[model samples]
Target: MVAGRNVLRALRDIRSFRVVVLHPADAESDELVAQIRRIGCRVELIWPPRDGIPDSTDIAFLLFRQDALTDAILRSLEDRPLAVTLIAIVEAESPTVIEAVVRSGASAVITKPIRAFGLLTSMVLAHKFSTGKLISAEKMSRLQTRLSGARVLEQAKAIVMSQRGVTEPEAYALIRERAMANRSSIEAICASIVSTGDVPGR
Candidate 1:
């Protein structure tokens, strides 16, 4: 009972999302729009994929055709990394269709005839997957920056030690003191030291 209530709560939160549908105005698209509206999300229907997703869209239901994969569709997929939860509307399960879906970077896929079943599940899962991907990307970027800063700091310390005949700890202390005096970061001070072969305020 508790888990059921939690699921209902999540479904209620789905109403807050803004959805965009890029499928043509056919029966399939109509059914999709109707179901999405039933789920309580604001829906915008756009025929023929656009070059970019709208700025307000939180989720996008894009039609993926194996033969009709144009540059505009590909651009839409490439440009909105981690911004929109893409749910591919595929017509078939052929190898070609599967490959296109993979290349499109869709977080989840909804196979046609656009039935009500599994649509909600796909939307929920896709949103979760997109959120997780964004978080992971941010964490990886921060880690890379820290690693690069560490390497530069080490080089700066070596330069200081070679020039002043001091130990590594003393070199780092000098860098810290200069950083504090200038109201800058240690990494900024170290970067300066590495570039100029002379510490600031010395």
Candidate 2:
């Protein structure tokens, strides 16, 4: 299924995930609490969490009333990769606060007097965005690795051409032959040449 479209489904489509509420206190609005329970999400409300959200948590609703607490929460979240969807609940907004929320990797935000349905929607959206972001980051990392390898290979090919007076194609062919003989990647063979000033199987 295409991401971000699952929310269009009926309420029955909502998956039961572990939901965590990080607040200054345990006393959450009864309406919001009741609504979350109705959707069958296992909810835990923790006030002044010392150790950040638990590993079992899949979604987090973070309530912020002061900048200091917000900074502290963000630091805790950054200490490790939790893969939890963050939803910020704020009573007031400021430029600094909004910037902090973005930097902290909040996927969605809800204001005070939280509506039952609005919270549900935010939860779903946060999960979708979080999943998509992770996938994109992974793809970017792979692309970066490939690009770095290519740059190294080019440099190694240049080294071969300069030393052996070979054409570009010949240099590449030489690298490929060594890689095949060694049962390794051309990049690995090239890296060996660049690093050790010698080709594999030479």
> Which of the numbered candidates is closest to the native, going by highest lDDT?
1
Scanning candidate 2 in windows of ten residues, the lowest lDDT window is 3-12
Per-candidate TM-scores read: 0.91, 0.85
Tens-digit lDDT string for candidate 1 (1-202): 9988867876777789999998889888888899899999999898765456787889999877766544467665686757688898888788877887788778998878889998888888888788888999999999999999999999999999998899999999989999999999999998998899888888
How well does candidate 2 score on lDDT at residue 73?
80
Candidate 1 vs. true structure, TM-score: 0.91
Over 32-68, each residue of candidate 2 has an lDDT whose tens digit, in order, gives 6667778888887777778889988888888766567
What is the lDDT, from 0 to 100, of the residue 148 in candidate 1? Answer: 96
Q: In model 2, what are the clashing residue pairs, if there are any?
A: none
Candidate 1: the clashing residue pairs are none
* Candidate 1 deviant stretches above 4 angstroms: 1-9, 68-71
> What lDDT, from 0 to 1, does candidate 2 have?
0.79
